[model samples]
Target: MAGVDEPECALPLDSRDVRCCCLLRSFSHFIVKNPTMNCSVQTPQIVGKDAKQHTLSPTCTGASVLGIKFSDGVIIAADMLVSYGSLARYLDVERISMVNDNTVMACSGDIADYQLLKRRVEEQTHTDSLLSDGFTLSPRALHSWITRVLYNRRSRMNPLWNTYIVGGLESDGKPFLGYCDLLGVSFSDDCLATGFGMYLALPLLRQRLEDQAGGDPRKLSKENAVQAITDGMRQLYYRDCRAFKTYQMAVVTSSGVEVRSPLQLETNWEIADYVAGYE
Candidate 1:
């Protein structure tokens, strides 16, 4: 009673009460400094009991990523439209990105998820560069890494909701084209397509390769590959309602990755005019 101070109140000092008192004291000081402040402590609102139970779904989505490998390099393309439901929301979205000097990637599905994946790839590439001394991830290595990442996310029940086409030249300068989807299933082919591209463009690509180069991607020239990719894109714009005429394409070779300017495919409405459903 002499040396020790009396309890602030007759009530026992509980930890919760102590915390509330400390907070009130700090708020009181803040109010003293700013007398105009409205110092009212409203009851905390309970918004939700399980915020983490919500499942993520794609809002803005892209469509139909296409890629083909040729003798000199690999070419990949995707449309610029990012759609919200049936409404075309964002135009001029670059769905294709160069991952390195010899590698490029095209993605279809959630544009936001693709952007997150792109940042992860960039961070991994930068880390590899910092640690490799001189060497960096080859096209195949990058593809494998991306596959594992997608698989891991899928296993966690939070997939990226995208299909990715990876294209580049190997360290030996051989053309490489690989595909991976939200479920993490991956494979390599002379040509690859995602989303509606698989249904609408793959046949044309395979036909072009077969007709022009005996179905061997390695036998196709750069011009042939570019033409085939552009043809596929044009067809997608015509057929795939999710697709747009404005698109971006990337050519990856041993020299480097060249992402051309966004190009618009020419369209003809004459067919629409002749259709029975035409207005």
Candidate 2:
């Protein structure tokens, strides 16, 4: 057996294949095939763990969004502030935006997530517009769509951290106000508030409606609705640490939607001298 010569292999095309075919195909059989020749061994590459794929923590976030329904239609307000943790990182950021000619939506949470949601909505709207049938997403339809999307993301455990308030005229020309949150929880309300506004501003509007409009949102005049939202935003600036004096509001009605540019709310620290906060 020691005197027996190895059988010939298929001729290799290059010098790289000089090590016999058996050894070239498998490093384990290299030394056995050719005792005098040497083969270079390569270590298998080890890939490291991948970085976190989804948004595990939100960096830029907005605060409360306040909405109210009046006899004319629905009005929603949000301060123009995007905070990085406790620091006010962005000023004059518009949290409330018009989704269509007749619909408006606002969010209180991670601005980036909301922006992504906005693009999705816009793409859907564009696709619908391509139909050219004069049909578009009504306030109710958009609200439902946003709810489903948020819920779907939540189910996947990578939620788009946003609490939304959508308002406008329904397909039937009736005023509609709907809310959706990060977990996809949603409901329609005559008056709605998210984030800090839920605790500080909601009660005020509810009380005002009860006292002036007999608890019926339709009884309130358009002026009253605007006044109520204004007051709520004002209160938020006074109380919500994340709230800014600068804000924006959108009014949706049978005619169309009007989103006011960023404006400063009139605030007063007059009572500051008389009151002291907890140490």
Choose the strongest candidate by lDDT: 2
When superposed on Cα atoms, how far off is each prediction in RMSD? 10.3, 7.2
State the lDDT of candidate 2 residue by residue for 1-279, as single tens digits: 232234476653453444454454476566677888855688875864664477777899999999999988899999889999999989978888788888999999999999999999989989989999999889899999999999999999899999999999977778999999999999998899999899999999999898889999889988887888889999999888999988898988887888887778887899878776766
* Model 1, runs deviating above 4 Å: 1-56
Q: Please report the candidate that would top TM-score against the real structure.
A: 2
Query: How high a TM-score does candidate 1 get?
Result: 0.79
Backbone clash tally for model 2? 0
Residue 83 lDDT, candidate 2, scale 0-100: 95
TM-score of each: 0.79, 0.80
Q: What C-alpha lDDT do the candidate models reach, one value each?
A: 0.86, 0.88
**Once superposed on the true structure, which residue ranges of model 2 sit more than 4 Å away at CA?**
1-53
